[model samples]
Target: MEEIERIVSGKKGKIDVTPIATIFRNEIKEEVTKGQMKPRIVAFLTTDDAGAIEYAKWTKIACNRDGIEFILKKIERLDLEDAIIDANNDDEVHGIMVYYPVFGGMLDAYLQDVVSPAKDVEGMSTTNRFNLYHNIRFLDEKQTKKCVIPCTPLAMVKIIDHLGIYDKSLPMGEHLKGKNVTIVNRSEIVGRPLAAMLANDGAFVYSVDISGVICFQAGKRQGTIKMTETTVTRDEAIQKSDILILGVPSPKFKIDESLIPEGAVVINFAGCLNVEESVESKTILVPTIGKVTIAMLERNLLRLYQNQMQSRSTSSSSSSAQIDQPQQ
Candidate 1:
């Protein structure tokens, strides 16, 4: 098998995210300084996943010097409802994030319960979802506008922007507009929101579940960019589009040399691939997507947090000033 192309790694070599991260950090710090705000406090509630713990740890570290605090708690009880209600009591905790795969159907409800609309950093709450769906208020005190957007989805958008793929000054959205972009999953966490985000920007987004993938053939080419959130759909989608975005790491899978479209860009967000068979002469497979995505998530979360804080402060000041002045 020939080597596959790795999009994230290749882009990393070309994309200097340090400047972006620095700018983001400075902006947030500036806001905190401007507001004379106290240190931020974060809380995590979720099942015990090493990845989740590590992510929370690093995020905490990043915010440490910047007057942001973080806390992590593993949910032993299956009752997330209680966890959320308890989260409300911690006035210092400005952000609430719930990790994935927490058993039962209570994840959403729990998130909704724990996260005040302003502090929904993960953007999983129903209120935030509704706000995003209606485009009611994209950025709050947060500059992003949308509340409760998934971290990954926001990272994808940021990555695209970093690459100058959709800068408003350049008539952005052509690459995705009306383009037949096919996503292979429908998980609310990823598929649904991302599809809506792309569609709202005018992309012709089509979701192909596991069953819809049976119809995929290696030889048939259809779209300009085919993105997959599951390993099962990567090879098929890679073979059909000029650009491919790969996420998920269920297990290693072989990538036949003939399975790639010539000159295609493949981004392996999974960071886990069968090296022996995945090697393609023309393909590039990135092994650091997991790390980069984590970074991206942290960056986005911070932005969302700052935005909320700023918005709240501005509103409070305005309300206070109005009250002091009385009727006009």
Candidate 2:
């Protein structure tokens, strides 16, 4: 694939993802503009956070520009579950997304599960997550329909691939086999899923969280994830890592600059970047990906829309085949 990356030229520099994002937007626009009607995504925001609100606004703008329908529904937290069910059952809605931190904890997890898999564009639904962690890439026995992946982590994968870290000549699951990675955040939304994704793709991953650092690696079995609890310290993990992906929401939770090693690939998904500005010079730094993340959201919506179309076509064919068969 051609490089779509933008460079920041100065004493301190990092990778600007605007061009990569533009490539994704152009592809999605081309993918949807051919059809008479467009796929629709319903996003529910039950939080009052400024960031979430702004994200919703941009999501609408991106979707509109890509020829996809976008709806932002600000509703009561209590009614959010019921509203998701309604959207799930609604035929016109091709995809669903929920802005986070609403009811933060187990309740938010429950809300994630409420969105049906077919309409889950964010790929946060239990079924999609389960499939992702298990390294299951398809939705059907025939493998005709593909499964959805969470937008942020998928964007991370794409960015890493664009950087040429993943060798295309290698087998699918063996691309990152020799690399050691460290992921700082362990949130269900991004970190944990990302750790599993890399581990599944054959990286030895050090998953760091508030609790401790755990080692994630590909399982002995063909399609499984192996998690091993470790006493590895954050700095230790950072020192040995080939790639470091960080995401932490708090402004006070910045990563120590001295911890980053030379010649490492650094990717940050935090709204408030967790790494120091100077680290940009020492590493292959990806400071932010606001547009690229939005692009992944649009891509997921298109994939789910395709899945829906395939399901309809299959059902219609089955019905016609039954009608054309001899009466029994």
Candidate 3:
């Protein structure tokens, strides 16, 4: 850790995300207020983890400000699955979020699968995960509606764009085609998904976990992703990365600061500090993503609401056409 201290002991810089989040928040607020949209979202908190509670609180506050009907429902871990199903069955609820670490491990994954795909605002369901990894843009075979993305990864990508890293002049699939990136967490929710998202966008990615490093990159075919074990050491990957991401949940775990290259972009989404304070001097540190997460959460809800509206309109139009047809 001392080595980390030595590397980042000087100047400091960080991306002020308030403006970016505000842009999203105001857009949401204006759309809802102007359109009179009452998109309802219910977030279930089944754990007493302070971080989860605080996140849920932020989610509710953001929703309220955006003029959406929001509820923070507290329930026991044992009943979370059933409660999610109830919310899924309720026509009034447009979106749903679950505070995680309830049961931890595969059980939590099972709970993720239980949430209805249409209402899973966080986009943590199995189907969404499949769509993300496979680069499927739409929820249906017709390809009319777009798929929902996990908020955190989307926020991170936004950060890169906001910071001027993404060359907008470049086409979509090639926006990040030239960058070498490193992400230091491999958890199912955040790390794994993020790596795939980056790879899908054409970045060469090094995904680091306790076991080892996995290489991720766009495949030879368009919209395809590939991952394989790599001989590149963590330090080597960090040294070469244009973008560095950290999401370790515990303070006990941290990047040895010495590994971070000077002027590299580093982003942290974890509640605890995953990198030393000094590293800010040597890197472009995106220290928090909570606000953007909230914005993305509401954004996903609006998308689902819009899809529902479109579906309703299409249904109505078809019904009218059928009724107007001459008797045959």
Candidate 4:
């Protein structure tokens, strides 16, 4: 845990996304008070898995705090796809999130594909995934208008920005440009999207799996991410990385303190034992996750509210125009 503290103390200080979340929540409250449409998020859970339940609870707390209504729908595995489709078509629902590890990981694909991109607050839909890969400005753009991004990776970026990893003077999207970032995991939810986002922002990203498969991709938007994979010892990648992100999902996974370069920025996304204690002071650590999720959810809800308000304004204007037209 000492390593965790050191990670927090690096750069400007302990990186906290709470302030970011608070800003969104306050904005949401203001909008609701002004008689704008209220936003609601529905979470579909097919299993009673501990992790999923915990996430559901967190999401509820976040929604409540942000002034958005939270609905939890527990359904059977067979009904998962239909349930997501229903939520997609529901005009009252602004966002949809499906808890994972359902049926021993049986329904992952359906959850990823069935949720509509418009309400996919977790950024699991194919359209959102493609946008994450192709648009570097996704995060900076209005969340309701752009592809919704996965909470964890979005949290990581916010934390890094909070810690001054990038120059504050530059725009948020350009912060990671030209940085060498190494992500030590390859999960579809976290590693893959993160790598794609960073690369899209002009950062040279290296994604490493536990099996020592290192995939290098240029952070450019002109073409497809032509990943060049090669097998190498893990230590080499650690030594070369400027900013290291730990998302490996193994409890026993630990990095050698000596391998971590001095002054490197370390982001612990998996909540696992990835960083050793010896290098705690030498690297900046970003360890919080809950606040980031809260922030992302608030941003998502605010965007939805904005879109709803815009639609209402347009309809109202059209109705007034029709009423003013001279009747024959």
Candidate 5:
């Protein structure tokens, strides 16, 4: 852990992440009026898993440091109904997130209940999803944002955006946009949401299923930019892409020097636990910890905080107006 942190610290000069998160946070705080207002509450809905707890802690710190109040909803040995009700009734809680996955179809039902549309920071609410599909998902007219973009997908895009230098020599949206970028697994949190997010960004994304097409699309989209959920090392997959995003730490797939295109920019969002075979020295390898995890959590918290501020300002103004009206 120390070595990893040191490695990340060394790269700080090259990639400054502080400003990136600050910019995002300020964007959220901007929507509110400057004055006395009700305190904003955010709930960190999570499970007993250590990772989830750690993530919740990160979120709590970020929120508190920014003057946002937060609460934790841990579903350790608790029934889903009780958990959902507890989350819903917490008036101080402006957002709800479910960090743990439940067994059977019960998880879906619980998610729907725990996350109210207005407070769905992670955008898992059925109503918010409905609004998303209908194209009406935004707090303001010109905002042009989704109600809640999945954290991982948002993290991936932010990293890409921060990188700035996309090889534009290969055309813009149409070339990479909507091209069949294949995802290996189909988890709702990652694959489904990622596919939707990427597609919304104008990329033709395909969440790989057993029956999906395997033939590469000749030119660009056919064989470019593969972002995988799990490890699947196909020589054709490696030889054919311009950008590769790896999101899993499983040992199933390993990239060899021969597999990747020369000078390919690879993003290992899978964290440092799984390192593929070293390619040429020119291969640009990006680690996920400092890049994706923190960035994504920071971004989501910022968005959620912004939405909370907006809601508070509106509520305060409405209350003031009502109070000003003479009693009947």
Candidate 6:
């Protein structure tokens, strides 16, 4: 087999995500300083989940480095919703994130629904979900008017854009035109949202699930997505795809090394051994979820602060105009 070039590791070596993360942090710190606001993020975590605990540790480190206060509240399965609600109502909490597998995923929906959309930094609220699905475009160049996007999908797109997969001169939705992309999972959090996003970006997207293959077409407003039952196997999809996304959360779901053609970009969202080691050199392995999540949290915090500032400025300008008006 011929040697495949690694996307993340190039001529200079493995791309340093640390510097990219630092840039995000510095920009956020500057925004917080200019706005004279203390930004804080509250994470509601399960008491016993080892993964959640480890994730929280990295989150704290990132928050500390960026000058944002990180608060971790341990809650039982029953009190999860209440904790999220409290975080939403707290004036100091600019962002709220809940670690998953809470009560073995039984309370995921309840916790997600209870968090206020304004504070839902993880983009789990119904409002954000609707906006993402509908391809709603916010006119504000600052993106303060749009809803928060899920970090994993956001990070994936950013990496791909950085790799010049998208035309830099054009808008995001026009970037992947003529590209054939395949996503190998359909979960709500990662796979489904990612498919919608990529489809909106004009890629010919094939979302594979046990049920069938769902084809997506980019529309002017609300894009069209159609699902059809098919007998196509995973290997068949991989063989024909230009870009392959794997989100299957199982070790047994490893891909056949021979199936991945040379120059195909592979992204693994599931933090497990789902892909073969040989693919690593040819793939862009997403950094740990915690790192990307922290970067996104900083972004959300800046947007929230900027929106608040803009609102205040608009209100103050209106008041001044009223004072200057002639009495009639």
The top-ranked prediction according to lDDT is: 2
Tens digit of per-residue lDDT, candidate 4, span 1-328: 3433444554323344566556556776676667645788888888777877887787788778667788999999789877877776676787888777665453586567676666667766666666666553342233424446777787777666555557556665556666778898887788888887676555677788856655656534453464776665567877877788887667788787788777888777775657764455676655556667666776766665565455556555311110111111
Please, what is the whole-model Cα lDDT of each candidate in the order they appear? 0.49, 0.81, 0.80, 0.67, 0.50, 0.67
Ranking by TM-score: 2, 3, 6, 4, 1, 5
Q: Candidate 1 — worst ten consecutive residues by lDDT sum?
A: 319-328
Q: Give me candidate 4's TM-score against the actual structure.
A: 0.80
TM-score of each: 0.66, 0.90, 0.89, 0.80, 0.65, 0.82
For model 1, what is the alpha-carbon lDDT of residue 260? 55
- Would you give me the overall lDDT of model 3? 0.80
Residue-wise lDDT of candidate 2 within 88-130, one digit each (tens)?
7777888888888788899888888878777778888777777
Clashes of each: 22, 0, 2, 2, 3, 0
Cα lDDT for residue 95, model 1? 63
In model 5, where do residues sit more than 4 Å from their true spots?
1-19, 26-47, 104-113, 129-146, 165-182, 202-206, 209-235, 249-257, 271-280, 289-328
lDDT tens per residue, model 3, 8-56 = 3432476557777888889999999888898999988976778777777
**Candidate 6 lDDT by residue in tens digits, 196-308:** 88877878778887777877657665454444445666678778887788777777878786787666777676767566766656554432344555787778766654554
Report the alpha-carbon TM-score of model 5 versus the true structure: 0.65
Residue range with the least summed lDDT across 10 consecutive positions in model 5: 319-328
Q: Which prediction has more favorable TM-score, 4 or 5?
A: 4
With a 3 Å backbone cut-off (N, CA, C), the pairs that clash in candidate 3 are: 4-258, 11-281
Q: How many clashing residue pairs are found in candidate 3?
A: 2
RMSD to the native, candidate 2? Answer: 5.4
Error in Å for residue 16 of model 5:
7.9
